[model samples]
Target: MKCFVAVLIIVTLATDAVSEASVRTCEPIKVAMCKNIGYNQTGMPNLARHTLQADADVTLQTFSPLVQYGCSSQLDLFLCTVYVPMCTDKVALPIGPCRGLCESVYERCYPVLSEFGFQWPAELDCSLFPAENNHEHMCMEGPGERTAPVGTVTLDSVNAGGRSACRRLIKPNSWVWVRGSSRCAQFCEAEVLWESGERRAAEVWLATWAALSFACTLAAVGAQLACGDRGSAGERALVLVALCRCAAAAGWGVRAAAGRTAAGCAKDSTTPTRMLLAHDGLANPNCAVVFLLLYYFGLAASVWWVVVAGAWRASVLRPSVTTSGTGTRNDRHSSLLQLAAWGVPAALAAAVLVTRDVDADELTGTCFVGNQSSKSLLALVIVPEAICLLLGTVFLATGLRAILRRPVPVPAPTALLTSPPQQITDQTLLRLGAFAALYAVPSTCILATWVYEYAWREDWLAAPVPTEIPSTQPRPAFWVFLFRIFASQILGVMVAVWIATPRLKALWRKIAGPRKPPLTKCPAGPPPTPLTLHCYATHSHSLSRSQMHKYATYRPPQQHSYRKPRHYHYSAGETIL
Candidate 1:
C-alpha cells in the first residue's frame, strides 16, 4: 500500500511538470492569438496538452491564403481566416469576431485538453494582436466567400478600397464593432442622415433667429431716427448700436444661407488632418468674405457703441456739468465714436485678412477666422471686445451708483403750500439700468462660451466623426451648443427691448402720423358797466363841452344815508328853556 501511494504521488507531480513545460514551449504568437480570441491563460494548461505547435501549424496552413493578401502577421491571418469563419458559421458577420473567436476557441479547446490532465494558463497576454489591421480583405480569402446583398448601401465608399469598412465604422478610440456589411451600411447611413438633418436644423435655427434680430434692430433704429436731433445723446448712440446689430444679424443670416450650398473642400477620408486646413478651401470666398468682415465689424461696433452710450449717460448724470457746451462735446465725441466703431473693426478685419485665413466652421455656423488663426481673433476681436465690455460694465456700475446715490430734495412746508409739487421721474436712470442689464447678457454668454471652448479645445478641434449629431454626445456638449446659440443670435432683440421707451414709442407714433389737437372755447362772462356823465366831464380834459352836455342828460342813481339822527341833546335843552 505504501509503494502504491508513492507511485500515485510521483505520477501527479509528473503530470504538473509536463503541463508547465508544454505551456512554456508554446509559441508566443499562438498563445496571444488564442488569448485574443478569448481563451484565458488560466486554462492554458489544458491547451498545452493539445500539441499547440501542431494545431497552430494546421491553422496557419488552412488560412495561408490571407497572408498573401497583405495580412500583417500569422496572428492577423488567423483572426481574419480560421477563427472568424469557424464561429460565425457563414451566417451574419459576428461583431468583433476576432474577440468572439478567441472566447469560442478557448471553450472548445479547453475541455478536450482537460481530458489529458492539463489546464489553460492564467497569465498569458492576448492584447498584442494587431486587431486594427484591415479585415475586409480576409473576407475574400476563400473561393466561396459571401458578398453584400443586392440593394444594400454603403457610405464613405469613395475611399472604401483603401481602408477596412469595419475600421471605418468603429473609430480608433472606440472598441465597439458592428457586424455584417448590410447592417454596418445601415448603421452608417443612419448616422449620416442624422448628421445631415442636424446641420440643416442648425442652419434654419440660426437663419430664423438672425432674421428676427435684424427686424427688431431695424425697428429700434427707425424709432431713434424718427426722434431726429430731439433724442438724447445716449439714444443717438443706441441708433449706431442698433445699426451694428442689424448688420451682424444680416451677416449671420447670409452665412447660414451660403453654407448650405457651399462645398468648400473635399476632406481626405483616410488620413487624419488638422481642423483648420480640413475645410479651408472656400467655393464661395466672396460670401465668406462678406459674412466674416461684417460679423467682426458689427460685433466690435456693437460693444463700443454700448461704451459710448454708457459714457454719455455718465456725463449727463454728473451734477456739476452743465448742458451749455453739450452740443460741441457731443459733436467731438460722436466723431471719435464713429471712428472707433467703424475704423477699429476695419483695421482688425484687414489684419485678419493679411495675417490669417478666414473660414467657416460648424462652431459659429458662419465664416470667421480659421482655427489656426484663432489666436489672432482672440487678440484683435475677442480681447478688445471683452475689455470694452468690462469697461462698459464698470461705467454702467458707476453710473448706477451715481444715480442711486443722488439726493432727493425734501420740499419745505411753505414752498409746498406756495407752489404745486413737481413730479420727479428717474426715467433716465431706469433706461440706463435696463441697457446695462441687457448688454451684459450677451457679453457674459460670449465670455462664458469662450472659456468653455478654450478649456475643451481638444474636443472642439478633434473633429469627431458625425460631430454635430447630438444623440451620441455628452451632456456638457449640449450646454455648450445652447450657450453659443443664445449668445450669438439674441443680442439684437434684447437690445431692442432694452431701448424701447416712451420717447421712442412717441417718435414711432409721429412717424406713423400726427393727430389733430382738440379745439378749446372761452367761457361766457358778465356785461360791462356804462360810464356816468359827471365822471366823464370831470375827467374829460380831452373831451368837448358838447360831448359833455350830451352825456350830462343821463341821471345817476341817488345814494341813501345809513347813519341815525343825533337830535336828542338839543331837544332836551329846548324843552327846559
Candidate 2:
C-alpha cells in the first residue's frame, strides 16, 4: 500500500508538471491558411474577371464587404495589371513578368477572402496560387531607387523615392492600398513570424507521448494476464474483450491517419510523398493506440477477477454433489460439471473473436483506430458480469459472518458412540450460497454500468482531446467514467500486487491453507480388510444337505458330511427342537 501510494504520488506530480509545461511551452496555432480554392482551368487569359467573382463570393460570405460590386471588376483588373507587375519586378527573374502574375495575386490575397478554407500552398512560385498560398494579404514593396557606392542608381532609397512613390499611388476607398514603407523592415516580415521550433516540439511530444501511453497500457494488461492462473472460461472471455478493443482502436487510428493524409494531400497535391509523410507525422493515432492498450489491460484485470471468484468457490464453498436418474443423488464430479459449463461458452466466444475481424474499415485509414466495436462489446459483457460479481461478494461475506457467529452444540455420550450421517453442514450450504451470490453480483453491476455508459450518449464518456502528456481533469459526475478507472484499474492493480506478493501469499497460506488430515481412531494399524458376505434364508430358497452335495459334486465329501446324523430320543418333560 505504501509503495502504491508513493508511486501514485510521483506519477501525479509528474503529470502536473507536464500539464504546466504544456501551458508554458506549447504554442497556439496562428490561425494561418489551411486551404484555398481556385479555377481548375489552365492558361485561361483574363483570369481577373473570374478571380474577382470568386473573391466577391468569398468576401460576402466571410469578412465585411470592402468594395461594392460595381467597382469589383475594375478593382480586379487594376490589381492584376498594377500589383502583379510591381511585385515581380526583379532583374533577370526566373519565372518572368506577367509571370503567371494573376496566380500570385490570388495566392497572396486568398487568406483574407477565405478564412475557413485558406491553406498553405506547396510551391513558392506564383502559379501555385488560390489553391495553395492562401496568406491573408499580399506584401507589396514600395517603389525605390538606390545609388550604389560607385554612384550607380538603385531602388534602395526608401525616403527619397520608394516611400514617397508608394504613398502617392494610394487610391480612394481601397482596402489594399499601401500607406507607407519602412526602410529598416522588409515587406515579408509579417508572414515570417510563423515558423517556430516550439510548435514542432509540441507536435512531436504529443505523438511520442501517445505512442508511449498505448505501449504501457498494453504491457500492463499483458502483465496481468501473465501473472495469474486463469481457467479456460476466463481466458476465453478476456481474449474476446481484448480482440474487440484492439480492432476498434486500430480503426480509430486509421481514421485519424486518413484525416491527416487528406489534409496533407489537399495542401500539396503535386507531391504525394509529402502527403504520405505528413500522414505518418500526427498525434491522435498515439492517443487511440494508448486507449486500446488500456482496454487490453483492463480486460486482463476483469478476467483475473472472474478467475479468482470461480477459484474461491471451488476451493472454499460448493461441496461436490452428484445426482443419478433414481432417487439417490451422487456427490462426486459436480465441480467438474460446473467447470465445464463456464469453459465451453468462453472458449467458443474466444475462438470466434480471434478468427473474425471486428470491422472492415481499418485498412482504409478511415475507420480502424477509433472504431466503436470494442466499446460495444464491453457494453455487452460488463453488465451481467458486474451483477454476478457483486452478488457473489455479498453472499460470501454473509455466510462467513454467519458461521463465525453461530454457537456450537454439545453431543451426548450415547450419541457420540455413533457417527453422524454423511449430510451437508450449514457451513457448506452457506459457502455455496455465498459463492453463487458473489460470482454473479459484481459482474452484473459492472456489465450494467458499461452498457449504460456506452449506450446512453455519444459524448457521455468522452476522452480528452489528444495531448503529448497525460492530463488531469476534475472528477466527472458519471460513476462509470471516474470510479471504474480509479477502482477497477488503478486500485485493482494495486490490490492485486499486494495480495499476490510472495510475503502476502505466505501469510495467507499460514492463515487459511490446507492442513494434514486427522489421525484415525484405531490404536493398532488398520486390520486386514474383510471380504463382504451375503447370506439368504427364505421359505423357498433354503439349501438342504442333498443340494449341498450336488453343488459340491466335483469335490469329495468328508466322512462326517457323507454320513446321516442319528438323534437320541428326548424325555417328554424336556423338549429338544
Best candidate, lDDT-wise?
1
**Over 4 Å off, model 2:** 1-113, 117-289, 317-452, 455-480, 497-577
Among all windows of ten consecutive residues in candidate 2, which has the lowest summed lDDT? Answer: 34-43
Model 1 stretches with alpha carbons more than 4 Å out: 1-194, 263-283, 363-365, 370-377, 412-425, 460-476, 498-504, 507-577
Local distance difference test values of all predictions, in order? 0.49, 0.34
User: lDDT tens string, model 2, 1-577?
Assistant: 9999999999998796465334332112111111111111111111232222334334333322212211121223324222122112221111112324445334334543453244433332444233221233333222222312322211112232222222232121111211121111112111111123432443344334334433433543454455454322323333333333333333333434544234221112212122211111122343234333333333443444444344344333333342232113212443553454345344434442353212211112221111223343443345434544664465456545654675665666675544343233334344334434443443454455566644543332222334999875322133343333223323232332322343344455666877779997876886655444232333344567776556535655567763343223433334312
- For candidate 2, report its TM-score: 0.27
The C-alpha TM-scores of every prediction are 0.50, 0.27
